[model samples]
Target: MPFKINTNLSALDAYNALARVNAQTNKAQLRLASQLRINSVADDTSGYRVGKELEGKVTLMKAAQGNIGAAKNTLSTAESALTNINDLLIQIKGKIAEANDPTKNLTALANDINALGDEISAIFTNTKFNDTALLSGSALPSSSNFVFQTGETEKTTINFGTMNTLDLASISSSGATSSNITSLSVSTLETAVQDSLGKIGNYVQRLDVKDDYLTSAITNATASVSRLFDADMAIEQLKATKGQIGQQVSTTMLAQLNFQPRSLLTLFQ
Candidate 1:
């Protein structure tokens, strides 16, 4: 190396090396402070984009899980109401059969039937979850009538059957007249309730499977995002320590090189 007084070339080179060590040290420290590998898109452009997309999917799947829970709750409410109605129908049928006996009080049995019918009507009208009616006489029964968004890119529809117009509360006509059992058709009403129960059971099974899948998908997606964005503490700490050591060594070398030019003045002394 040629000695020069105008410019200390050796010092300049050392200074540049020091600057590089300082930059590397700062990058490691930043990662340590933030606890993230990719703090900005500049860190890893492709990783950042893909990680954000995965995070968005996780959000949507979480919402879909919530929807599945709500759908199950609604079905549960409907099932409860229908089960109670089925029980009442059973009681009414028994009362009608007893009315045929010679010893049974026909008028009293008819009153019992009316009271049971009223209870069933009350259940149908009052059944609800979150203020949305599950079973009411006015709902009108149909197949796959109610819709619920149960998953990402998926939907589930349920039946909300109504028994309001069945006239269960007034099965026995004119207070003293025969029940006119054929006109009321308690058996048919019971069958409809049973069918709703079966459908609800099936729907719940499907929901359970779907919920399990969402739970797993969410877990895996979150892990993937973490791998893309989260910092490794051990690796970052090692790098920071190495950079700090390099910075110290480079600074010492720069100071020595900067002092070398001053030796040239000794000739004048």
Candidate 2:
């Protein structure tokens, strides 16, 4: 290369190289400071897009988990109400059996049996959670199934079936007389309580399984999001150190190259 007084090509080349090194150093430092591999879309376009999609999915999944929790709570509240209703039915059955005995006073037995029936009706009407009725006839849905969202996908749902009215009127308890009580089918009331309890038990078990599954899924999704977005601190620090060294070396070379043209001028002196 020919040496020129007006322009030093070697110094220009060294300065450009130093600028590139400085830019790289700044990028590495930014990664270390932010603790994210993809701070901007320009850093890694495809990775950034994919990471954003994954982040959205994670957010939706978290919201779905909250929905699942609410569904579980609703089921639990219903289950507790049904359990109380079941106990009330058992007491009603005992009262009916006592009224069946010939030795008991008919009027006193009728009063006791009617009192127990009133309590059962009261429970059926009063059983509520979050101000929403759970056991009353008014609370029964037209469709048996209650769907709960369990995942990010629109199709992912947990369908709960078998919700039914637990009204005291469902059971034949108007027969307060001993002769009438002897004819009443206590077995029918027993069967209704047992069936409702069984359905509630099954629903609670399924909800528990779904809750565990969501917990695991959230953990895995969080890990995936982290892998896409989070920077490895150790690797970033090492890269920053290497870039810093390269910048120092390039700056020194640029300074040396600037002095080379002056040395050529000393030849004339």
Candidate 3:
């Protein structure tokens, strides 16, 4: 018999099998932890790119939604104040009618009417949301910038329209010889009130349009986010199955390699 050293092919086969099994195990774990088919850039670079884009849009949409909420509240306050002004104007009209009568005195009524005008003026000046008055004498900007995760504006045009300017000073202050009150025509007061009411209606309509836009933006953002990051359970199940099969096949191949080393036993026979 020839003197020879035998190599442990079984050990080499076992090592190879174990290495493959370890690799498959690691891949399965990564998929589970990340809950994504394309966890790394190597997996799907395009998916990562588009996923980040959608994520940015979602962030912008959230900020826009918050702005809409603030706009709604401010507009509501404007609407409420306008209603109070309407009531005040009606009261002033009644006072003027009483003053016109021969039985009533004008001096006391003039003071009361002046006070009502002052109160309306104050409401216009002082009414504020976060200390930014919507109906001030000067038109203040009710503007905000929505910053996205990508540090850019996804859609820049966010206008809540302008606030109504119902100038209280324009109303007549004279008691006995006023153009609006002394020459009292329901048509004139009605026209003024109707104009204010029309402005209020217009603002309310604008508010509704903004609200609807925000709602739609949020919906679309949510859908985009889901598409970008949500996992596909069906695809993951298939991958897991394939990983198990690969592990099994490698183990079988390793066993066959081990059998090759056992051929040395035939020499002894």
Screening candidate 1 with a backbone cut-off below 3 angstroms (N, C-alpha, C), the clashing residue pairs are 137-164
How would you encode candidate 2's per-residue C-alpha lDDT over 127-188 as one tens digit per residue?
66577666555654445445667777642232223334433443335546645655545465
TM-score of each: 0.89, 0.86, 0.70
Tens-place lDDT digits, model 1, residues 1-269: 67689999999999999999998889899999999999899999999999999999899889989999999988888888898888888888888778777788776876777777767767877887777667664443453266777777788887754444445545533432344532344777887788779888999999999999999999999999999999999999999999999999999999999999888888889
Query: What's the residue-level lDDT of 221 in candidate 2?
Result: 72
Residue 178, candidate 1: alpha-carbon lDDT? 47
* Highest-TM-score candidate: 1
Ranking by TM-score: 1, 2, 3
Residues 52-117 of candidate 3: C-alpha lDDT, one tens digit per residue: 877777677667666656655665776677677678778778877887786666666666676777
Candidate 1: how many backbone clashes?
1
The CA root-mean-square deviation of candidate 2, after full C-alpha superposition on the true structure, stands at: 2.8
Order of candidate numbers by lDDT, starting with the best: 1, 2, 3
Worst 10 residues of 3 by lDDT: 143-152
Q: Which portions of model 3 show Cα errors greater than 4 Å?
A: 1-25, 137-139, 142-197, 264-269
